[model samples]
Target chain A: MLVIEGLLKRYPDGFEALKGVDVTIEDGELVALIGPSGAGKSTLIRCVNRLVEPTEGTIELNELELTTLNRAGLRRARRRMAMIFQNYALVERLTVMENVLSGRLGSVGFFKSLFRRFPQDDVDNAFALLEKVGLEGLHDRRADALSGGQQQRVGIARALMQDPDILLVDEPTASLDPRTARQVMGLLADLCEEHGLAAIINIHDVPLARDYTDRILGLKAGELVFDGPPEELTDDVLPEIYGGEDWSKEPSEDDEEEEDIRSSGQFLAEEVL
Target chain B: MPVEQREDTVVWRRRDKRQAVIHWFVTLGIAAVVLWCFKLIADDTTWEFVWSAPEQGADLAIRMFLPEWFVDIPQLWRDGELWVHVAEYFRQRGLYAMELWDPLVDTIHIATLGTVLGVMIASPLAFLAARNTTPSTTFVRPIALALLVTSRSVNSLIWALLLVVIIGPGMLAGIIAIALRSVGFCGKLLYEAIEEIDENTRDAVKSTGASGMQVLTFGVIPQIAPAFAGISIYRWDINIREATILGLVGAGGIGMALQSAIDTLAWGQVSVIFLAILATVVLSEWVSAKARAAVT
Candidate 1:
């Protein structure tokens, strides 16, 4: 379980990115964090991993306080949680196998990792995760040689290699197309289910978030406004979280086109499973 | 204002009248200064010698081309020798060929060793100088940058002169000079490359809970590997050319041969030495180009 109590982040310029937010997540729960741009969705997830350090309050993962750990202690804490990025941040020149094996860097000695020598079990696990993510035969290829969707799959494989308790994903599908986005999300959902892993995914697409995740948390201007199951995230609640937009408006032609794409995305998601 | 209203339609001029006038005056001032500098140079030049330069150059070229491959051609001619002079010419050529090989080999060794040593020294300094990789920007980076600048400010020839005096004339002096000069060139470029690496990729690696050194190996090094390779090869190519001249300062290479030939007025031997240096430089250039292309 992960618990955040009064988590606050105020930048040096005195901009409050997270305003005393509190939340708790149980194991096996895959939750979606939705907000408009600059609503602290990214900030909140980063704070959990201490990537963006919190100025005040506490973040506890499995009852271990994260905010006050020293350098070595933080590394130990970080091993229990993994982060995925929007850009699929693979070392572009490195081979896929190397990139995946890098996830075990914290566990290995410096010289062993430096010489590209990972333990055989780590290598075997990397191969297994590569196969699990459907990148079965491209392990020798450089990261930049893969397509964006393929790269994101490699990113997922790398994160899974960490064997972490929680996955902090920051806009994983933001750079992907609609179909590929749903497929990647579906893969994450399936993997989380199999491992009973807790995850906080920051997603922009409302329908996709609602489809894949069990729960949704809405942030608006550094404050948590709504936290509920996906079924309870109604149109009335959206205006409160997203602010003053007409929730009951008639669907436009563009909305109908989007509906078609979403339906096709759903089909692709099912195929991924 | 750059945007103004004219009658009904709005008029947009890139520069208003005041800016245009300022620009024009600036151009005129630069032109006047250039003309004055040209006049100063013209006044100081001796035109009489300048006019005779072509004839002097042609005479020197003629002397240089007539290589001294034969050891006493005039004496052989005076004694009424025919086939004997030809045999003597072949013998002298053979002897000269034997003399040239060692120094040419020495020059190659100097450059190769110098480049390796320089890269070994520069790689660590590059990390210290790079803003992203340095342990402290204010304290560590400035010292590293100062070292790089000091290395770069002095030319390899000057370095060779100092080393020859201090270390006693040999290949060691030539190697150290080349390595010192290369430290700055390699460090500056390597640091710039490091600063431009993809930070997002590094962040991802750090998020894996890797140690600082591990993050450097996995996150930073791979991104800068190609740039490092290209810099090393490019520096080696330049060092090959520089190594030839180091022998002039008693740092052992083909340059020592050239200096002795010039001192004895053996223009032909000087020409041959020049040709050998040219060939070595061209070969190194080609090799460096191919190596850099392969890495990139």
Candidate 2:
């Protein structure tokens, strides 16, 4: 469980990226944060991990106060809340195994991690996670050698290596094609269900979010405008979330094509389950 | 179309006369300064000596390349004594080769040790100078930059000369001088490499709850390793060449033999030492290139 209240992020230059916002996520729930660019979706997820420090809020993770922890305590807390980046930010020069093993950095001591002397169990678990993420035999390859989808798979495996309770993913499929994006979202949904991990995914595609995630949180200009089950996110509320777009227009040919692809993706996701 | 054409023509005709005058003035000023420099050189130098330099060089080349004690062609045909002089020359070269072996070895060792020492000192200083990695920009960055500037401002020869005064002249002075000169070179390149590392990768490493040092190890070091290896190998190649000359300032290397030969007018030994230095440099260049290829 994660609880955030009145979270605010004011940049040093006086730009308020996130205004007062509140959110609570339960265990085993997959929530999609949907908004246009600069809607503070990324900032909200980053705040949960303290990657972006909250200016005026309290964050509680499984009843532990995360906002006021010291540096060491914060690091330990961070180990339980793994993050997946949109760009799959693996060290390009490091091998996949090394990048995955780095997820155990907070658990191991400095010297041990520095020398790359991960425990036997950690190594075993890393290999298992790699297999689980469908990268069964590419552990020795360099991170940059993998394709975009493969790299994101490695990113997911690396995050899971932390044995995290709640995964914070920031735009996981933005860089991938539509087909690969649906596949990645299906994989994440499957992983969440199997592991009972709470995940907050910040995403851009509204149809994918509605079709896949359990719930949706909508933001517009740093404020949470809507929060409900995906079925309740009607067209009327999208205007509130995306700031007064012409929602009454007739569906164009492109929209119909997109709708077909999205419905098929939903069907595929359901079939996988 | 006529109005637009007329307007375009007017605009084209209206050149910036002031700018053109400034450009002409700048060009003329540069030319004047260059001509003044040439006039100063011509006034100070002896033109007769400059004109005679080619003839003087030819005369010295003839004296250096030819020996009056050489056997006549008719005498060689009569007695086969030409092989005797050639064998004597080879024997003398062999003895010089034996004498040069230790100094050549010392030069290589000095370069290796100096490069290692420079890398050791430069790595931490580079972290301090890197904008992203520095602990404190106001304090640490400035100090690191100043140290790098100080190291770079002095040439290795000058550093060797200074060290010889303090250390009383040995391989130690040569090694220290090379190391000091290399610190700035390595640090500047390493810091640039550090600054150019992918910010997203660094943030990803930090997100793993890794401490600062862990982030540096897992994130920063991997990205910089290839650049570091290439820079170190190149510096070692250059240091080998520099080490050959350190002995001129009483720092131990083949330059000591070259200096002694020059002082005593032993041109043959000087030529031999030059050949040895050339061979060492070529070998180092080859090794450096291979190492760089492997690393990158």
Best by lDDT: 1
DockQ of each: 0.80, 0.70
lDDT of candidate 1 over B170-200, digit per residue (tens): 9999999999999999999999999999988
Model 1: clashing residue pairs? none
Off by over 4 Å in 1: A247-259, A263-273, B1-13, B67-98
RMSD of 1: 4.5
What interface RMSD does every candidate have?
0.7, 0.9
lDDT, residue A185, candidate 1: 95
CAPRI level of candidate 1? medium
Candidate 2 regions exceeding 4 Å error are A247-273, B1-22, B68-80
> Looking at candidate 2, what is the lDDT of residue A127?
91
